[model samples]
Target: MTATLASVPVRSRSFAFILGSPRSGGNTETLARYAAEGLPPDSTSGWLNLCDLPLPAQPAGPVPSGAEKVLLDATLESTDIVVASPLHWYSVSAATKLYLDYWARWIALPDVSFRERMRGKNLWAVTAYARGDDRDTEPLTGMLRRTADYLAMEWRGALLARAHRPGDLEADPAILSRAAGFFDPRD
Candidate 1:
């Protein structure tokens, strides 16, 4: 039998939801939250809204900024990192891009050992797009998959939803239902 997310003990796993949506409580966030519902009640879930904590366009070289440190700490502490970013212009939002850019700085910091630490961590994505098919979200997915490969992190897959309006996802029972077991460990 396959072990599910809920079957895993709390101490062995933690989740970090990095919300990169421009607005809070959007479709992508909702989808990710639905998937998170499958976790055990005692699980540690760190919800970081990129909209609230924006990353500066410029990196502070090797020294991390306050916001960066907050994000960095969460990233390092999690066993799973769910990037909940809406598909903007067929890709991730600006805030999400900036956050990913910081990874380069983190890798070059000499003392941070960011890449080494990220190894074996699970990387998941939740993205919603309008006016297109699955191919539209492929670029975003590819980027994330490549990132996971580069870091030696496990590519745990993605939750892609089609949402044009603010509440489109909430109205879609099928997508929401799929989300319920999105994190169930697959063989």
Candidate 2:
């Protein structure tokens, strides 16, 4: 079921899908949605489109009280954070970078306790690249791994898929099958 970041009550398992693609319904977003299907029936999932959430690139100071604050709230409230972005130059999209950059500022807020609160939470990624060896995605994955390690968050791995066109993922059964189990908890 669809849930909003603000509407997601403090609960057991809530996920926040932060879409970083400039366009909607792209391969990366589709993969994330498919992965969300693997969540338990009672789990709640929220979608936050980074394209719609404009973050200023000013003198680089404290976190603003607008969309950034909303994003911060969503990040803190969710048990798992899914960063969905199309591979850009073997790394995350600019929008995704902007969103992640705010974490540093938030961590220094003193009152937010952002780093401590992020500990134990899950960090996952869903990304699609047009062409390249599978290993080419290492830069993106490695960055995420480092982010998780720094925050003491659990590295939940990633759902990496190959898709060139917009609807390529929708037609790929193998990728679909992989996404079906992407979120299944490992024992």
Candidate 3:
């Protein structure tokens, strides 16, 4: 007798992560955790660990692969999104860049526009850099801003932090405080 595998239904959550870096104990993960702390308990959140997912290179045709569609769908369904990343060569990590490239597929879909799906969605960025210089984050911030604008998502400010070494963010009180403000904005 052959047994068929059962497909578990995926949960429809209100929040999700578009994580850029795959490394653990990095600034990106730290920042994501901080931002998540402020979210209401009832809201469901999913972390799309970029390292675990197999995102192929950009396709040549108009239709995006099934994998790309799933990713876009997950983000579109979320009410609040946090794009977490660490600075790589003064810009976002390659993993995050690949994911963002897939957005073009969503834009090409007829009757379901990328702008419409992302409209009114609250979007925030969290970037970690090794340098204390605040300007080091300009490239990443600018890229994120442009991407958010293209997607028609609302820009909800960014949380930037500096860490000299791995796990250094834990010792930075200023970063922690800034993170708190980003997650729970008083104004």
Identify the leading candidate in terms of lDDT.
2
- Alpha-carbon lDDT of model 1: 0.88
TM-score, one value per model: 0.90, 0.90, 0.82
Tell me the lDDT of model 3 at 55.
Answer: 84
lDDT of each: 0.88, 0.89, 0.76
Kindly list the per-residue Cα lDDT of model 2 for residues 75-109, writing each as its tens digit.
Answer: 99999999999899999999999899989888888
Backbone clash pairs in model 1 (N, Cα, C under 3 Å; residues 3+ apart or in different chains), count: 0
Ten-residue stretch with the least lDDT total in model 3: 4-13
Q: Tell me the alpha-carbon RMSD of every candidate.
A: 4.3, 6.5, 9.2
User: Candidate 2, overall lDDT?
Assistant: 0.89
Which runs of model 1 end up more than 4 angstroms from their true locations? Answer: 1-11, 40-42, 185-187
lDDT of 3 by residue, 1-187 (tens): 6555555553333878888786865777878788777766567788887877758885645665466656777887888788888888888889888887777766778866777878778777888887757698888888878777877777877888887676687787888777766756342
